[model samples]
Target: MPMQQRMEMWFQAWNSLMQDMERQGARVWPLIIDPPALLDEIEAREKSLGISFPPTIRKILQEGSRQVQINWSLPSRALDPFSLSGDLGWSLDAFEWPYFGVDEECEDDKRYLSFHVGGNGDMLLIDLSTDAEDPPVYSWGHETGEFLLLGKSFTEFVERVTELGCIGAESWNYEALACEDGLDVEGQVAQEWKEWLQAFRTLTLDEAVQDFEKLVVFAKMHGAEDERIQAAFAQYDWEQVLHVWVKHIEQETTSSNLLPWCQLIVKTVGKKAESWVLSLWESEHCERLGSSLRAYVTAVCLPEEEGLQRVIAEMDEVVARKECLLGYAANSHLHHFRAREVILWMEPHVAYPIEGWDDLFAVSRPQWLDLIRWLDGNEAQRQIALSAWGKMLANGESPAGEADWQEIHRLLDVAYEKAILRKEKERVDRIRSALETTMY
Candidate 1:
């Protein structure tokens, strides 16, 4: 498939996730980008830097589309996969890469091409040596002052990194990377979407409710996961899907279909589904759970702030008893992430261990970090999370829990970089130096 199609599939996946996250009042992603630099512009950048870009990098720069860039909404996938977008193609020397290591023979300007970067300063780089067709990608670890192999070649990097983006897997998945197998992620995600598209294409409006679960099983066998439900819904007509989905849910509402169906209405159908969803919620069939109630959003549909306020109060009442983040709320918050009170509400709670903490720190840790990010947390907040996750990594089971630590490492890097931006340079230096000390 074309790269554009691959991206469209990715946009389909993320758009739904963005909506759900937005419903929680999170700031949408902050990484804005422009179109790829033109070939002449690429050469101009190379001329200014006094070195030739690696062959693969040059090809990408040349091949990349100069079309209008994707807006905040991801309105277009017209560009090439390798977005040298925005202030990209900037050198690593700016971030002090030379301070870590240097060649006696080579000048600082002729060193590396920074192709990809995390929000933190961690970058995936291409060594600009000999203008090879495909150079090995490397990351200069600020904590260790070492250059680590990220990928053996730019092609491999694209395959592996595209998979990471698709599955939201950890970067530098060592096990997969070790044998030089890149999980063929783009193909997998794209194929899964194709299967969903075909399944829905075959689907008839008069489809019997009894066969609904069978259809879901069929889709799963063809590579459907619950997380992709919204992406799947994005492909087909909502009213048509709703027509079939309601019939299926009418038969059995227990599984992933309920949330996806509810999401379809709240997201796509908006106000059209409002009175209907409300009536459905009150009926014996809808089961007035937190998930059911919090779907109201003023932006998409559900402008009835009075109704949403009622939902919030009920959610507060449940949490008042349990004290756990999930506590009695059980996957429901008042959907107040955007509300003015959320930061003040979330701040005091972060310091508390709460009434029912457990080994399943899974949900709480990320939740806390997200809240802190939105709260504009300081160095102290980053320190608390880093210190805690360090212990968690140490106590965690070997090999199996390794991915968790990798994720935490990535998140902490982001948190620390945020501090660096906040003029907590001293704090960030200490944090990196402390991590450096751990290497010894």
Candidate 2:
């Protein structure tokens, strides 16, 4: 059979199975397939990317972008029941052949077309360098920078995924049975709000302002006292809303959840809110609230050189006080800012070792390694660094792989030399003892 015909058959079977499951009270969210991309859009994307997508890929794009949630516990040919639940679907632009360039440090063979990113940052990639009509599917681990072959072709990959039931597990409602009322009031309300907000995307500026007022009224009916919402409703004052959110942020007792709403307001108002968010850095609030504000500003507002300096200063204070610094450093926004400056600021503090290094390492190994290397000098820093490293190694916090092991030993060697230069016999002996057990 033709590959496209086979794909259509598989999709039909998959959709039928999902419908059957839903009818059987499986609480499944049906797959969302986006409209097909235009040929001109595809051509433009190909021109820009400088690579022609394979026939199988083009067929999949023609079929439209698909997002579905699968209930793994239910019968399925495509997924492991034990695998973590999450959404799986190609984005609309994935079909439009958006740029999927390899990272600078990645090997030449690592060049692949990324489509869906798993909830855990694992990527579904098509190996472009393989020169196949339909490139083999591979899973790229963000943490390890490793690829695991999944299937020989896109058709086979879809079949395997459907069999494993992996694509859309997160959309399933496990606790849905418990909500016996047959209606999720909160969810419905939130959904309605989201729909209204989405409508603003297509509305004229005047219409958006009118709808914005209606949204505020609706929010008020729900007992929401957010000043930003109120400010928007009254006179469409976005600057006032920004000011109010900044004030709320500076309050020590403010809930962290409010940060997102503040960001939403800033985003709705556009670049005007950017300056307002940045101005909050100098607010006379407690260090915790100030830090939180800085984090929100850096993450949501906009990237600025001044914002990077503020983050570094915040880290310096955080480190000096032996406070939790990982949250700020690990933020996705900080990566967009001065990543190198952030890493440099974080290096000296690795000796103290904040509480969330393991989580941080999973997100950014390169930055983690840089901090690990900073432990190479100074007797006090070496002692703290070695102790932390030894503990993590002993507890199996570090992955037991050859690459990781070699890196660990390299750092250990540096620490050992530092211990010797400091003439700290006890520390050197301790390091030697740890090394004895660690080295193969």
Candidate 3:
């Protein structure tokens, strides 16, 4: 059948599918692809049909065959109805069953457990083992496909799984079986499990402290030589190396371990880390933590002239091209531009004049014109122009007189014809300079 016709058939089968789930005492997660909810459509279809499919029938239609969606609990989960409009007449049952499983640690004699379904209306079961720190052994069968292994019960299974650790094994552990051929199927199945085990088993608080101490010494003794290690030796909260560093620093020892760690904080994280720390600073509920963090940043990072100079140079570039830095214009990433962030950086140390109304006007006119052009459409454009013109005019340094208004309009028209919005600051600067000269 053509894809469009298959989609219609799926739509026609929607009522029967919902009834099937309800019959099995399972909640029906519909696969409707339309908005405004599929319940109303299902009701109308059911009323027209004068019958509903059994739970098995619904399971077959919904998941036993992947005609469309696997689950339809929300609008986001709904299959794209348009997708059904193509050649999509394949069935999920044709390839046996695909049961959706969740991560849970417990089940009776089961290390890993899941669900699947068969045509006989029976839900088959799947289970796996959890012997190694890495991915455990698991198994699956064709009968348990239609089940949705939910979270609450999964937690209960996890508790039981802890109890059953390594005592029982009746069948082949799917993960181990798959690994004998060197595939490490369970490892491939869920790599997060491997990472979690690695973190839990390999990285203890004490071990972390030892490594951190080593890192500190390595950074200070060979700051320039071991720049890579020094660079990598950051006490970043997310780093695997952080927990140890924090502990060692609190101990107040001054041996090689103590000196390097203290020095590492200054060398690696001190001044450079200050800006990053502020970026994450929050003033709401996290104000106390932010204050403490700021204190830490200040205490550890000694002011280095070289570091400060580099930071200042970066800030100056950002401030000079504020339009690009502020995302008011497309900027070449290689060439830095001026920004408010740079101004904030310099404000503490430098005696700088505050920008006035003229500066504001000079910065905004081009932005206003660009916005106007983008919004110049049908009703939407008309509404935006009417609503926004007053705000735009309010930002002008000197209000345009009759001749000035005529010139501004002409230039704007020229901008539209040119279809480019580059060098706007220069354009406005020239115009303002000419106006000043004419006045003098």
Best by TM-score: 2
Model 3: lDDT of residue 30:
49
Give me the displacement of residue 170 in model 2, in angstroms. 11
List the candidates ranked by TM-score, beginning with the highest: 2, 1, 3
Q: Which tens-of-lDDT digit does each residue in 53-160 have in candidate 3?
A: 333323334433333332311112111111111011112222222233444532442333223322233332322232322222233332443222211222222222
Model 3 TM-score, all chains together: 0.22
- lDDT (0-100) at residue 145 of candidate 2? 61
- Clash total of candidate 2: 13
Clashing residue pairs, candidate 1? none
* Candidate 1 to truth, TM: 0.32
lDDT, residue 358, model 1: 18
Candidate 2 Cα errors over 4 Å, as ranges: 24-27, 63-87, 95-104, 108-110, 167-440
lDDT of 1 by residue, 81-175 (tens): 12111112222222222333454643533477655444435565676664567787665554454466656776565555433332211233222
